[model samples]
Target: MRKKGAYQQYKDVQIKTANQGKLLLMLYQGCIKFLGLAIKCINDKDFEGANNYLQRARKVINELMSSLNMQQGGEIAENLAMLYEYMNHQLIQANIHKDTEKIKFVKKLLLQLLEAWQEIINGSNTEENIDTNLSINI
Candidate 1:
């Protein structure tokens, strides 16, 4: 096996230091990356490579689903779980049929989810900035 490169080491440290919300965003980004690769592999007539990428994407979706806090997150968690399930089903069908169209559709769905997560991250950062700027005027 090859030794870890500098970039890989840096990414590891970044992930280790990231908060939960950032970690969640990373997972979504991973899903989008894998799905995009899977689509490209299909376009290249590399069904095997596509299958591997799709399976990796499915694993990320499963992780996201399993990490949901149903007890605390309630309806939002449940909704996300359902969406993840649908994506997994779509991925399985794409893998079995080696369909580029299905892969594109799933990629689109994942991209939408990633965008929403990014917006949420940005919104929280804005709120944090506002909180830090406020002074307790007695």
Candidate 2:
């Protein structure tokens, strides 16, 4: 409640924000790796590796889903939901037919998603410097 004590509060918030950003970076990295592995497996015609990547991706996705709150309003939530739906469909179709081409297509789509997300992720670095007191949770 005191103005002089606000500095510690501000520092705490910055640390928390940094931690969340790191978590997101980890998520994105995981997705990228899964997609890479899937693409590799597809190119090599390794159905087993492709399946393994899909399972790993599912685990990464589960962590990201925890941030979604369907009962509340969120622009990010809506966008991610749409992406998830599309990704799910593509992944299932690829798996069903054991199709390498289809898996490659889906991997491309995921790459685009990662590139877009990277902009925001990298932007966080710049943001942290100018707005140390700001907090963003994703």
Candidate 3:
């Protein structure tokens, strides 16, 4: 196997060191980035590229959904899981149809979630508070 590049190694270390809240934030950001790329590809009439990016975003949503702790999170986790499912469906439709509007809708939802998470993580002075804010399992 080829050796990892400096940036890849750095990213690995960063992920290993990050807190749960930070990891969640990263996932949201990554999904948003992929969706943005998909939008650009759609605008350029690159259906293959858009499909690839949409698939990546869907995977991130899957990860987020899997991380949710229904037992501990109650109604909130259930709602989030449903929302994630809807987002994934939207992504699939966007991919199949090369629909930039659907991608934008999903990206908007992710941005809103990301902003809420940032507020929760930033406002917390204690790890316990962070844990409380996060409906998903660490």
Candidate 4:
């Protein structure tokens, strides 16, 4: 296999080994990365490239929306669904207008959301570590 094919396989295996929380984190980060790339493409007058990146970002947002478990997640899931929908609409407008500012706005929102998720995951890890270090004697 080619070098790119090997790298892709490695990435797939890494993702497969990650838990759901990490997968969600990766999706948010991927969306932000694509949005940033689209912004740069727009700055360089590469509308076609910008549109491609924006479309990729939209796909990530769609995946995030679809992964939400409304019944179990409650208000949080509903709010995330609305945010994802709004981001998709903004991306559509950005693609149509070739607006770099809108892409920046959306990237900022994704970064903020990603940070929130990171905190939750980090806190969970800390709690787990603390529990593991504790000793209970009967």
Q: Write down the worst ten-residue block by lDDT for model 4.
A: 129-138
Candidate 2 lDDT tens digits, 21-107 = 455656666776886787788778998988888768766666566555554526766777677667667777777676667656656
Candidate 4 per-residue C-alpha lDDT over 1-138 given as tens digits, one digit per residue, 9 for 90 to 100: 445688888999979997666777888999999999999999999999999999999999998888776765677778888999999999999999998888889999999988987777666665444222221110
Query: Residue 77: error of model 3 in Å?
Result: 0.8
Screening candidate 1 with a backbone cut-off below 3 angstroms (N, C-alpha, C), the clashing residue pairs are: none
* Candidate 3 root-mean-square deviation in Å: 1.0
lDDT of 1 by residue, 76-110 (tens): 77788898899899999999998878878877887
Clash count, one per candidate: 0, 0, 0, 0
- Please list all clashing residue pairs in model 3, or write none if there are none: none
Question: Quick one: best lDDT, which candidate?
Answer: 3
TM-score of 2: 0.62
* Candidate 2, superposed: residue stretches over 4 Å from native: 1-18, 69-73, 125-138
Predicted structure with the largest TM-score when compared to the true one: 3
User: What ranges in model 3 sit over 4 Å off?
Assistant: none
Candidate numbers sorted by TM-score from highest down: 3, 4, 1, 2
Alpha-carbon runs more than 4 Å astray in model 1: 125-138
2 or 4: which has the higher TM-score? 4
Q: List the residue pairs that clash in candidate 2.
A: none
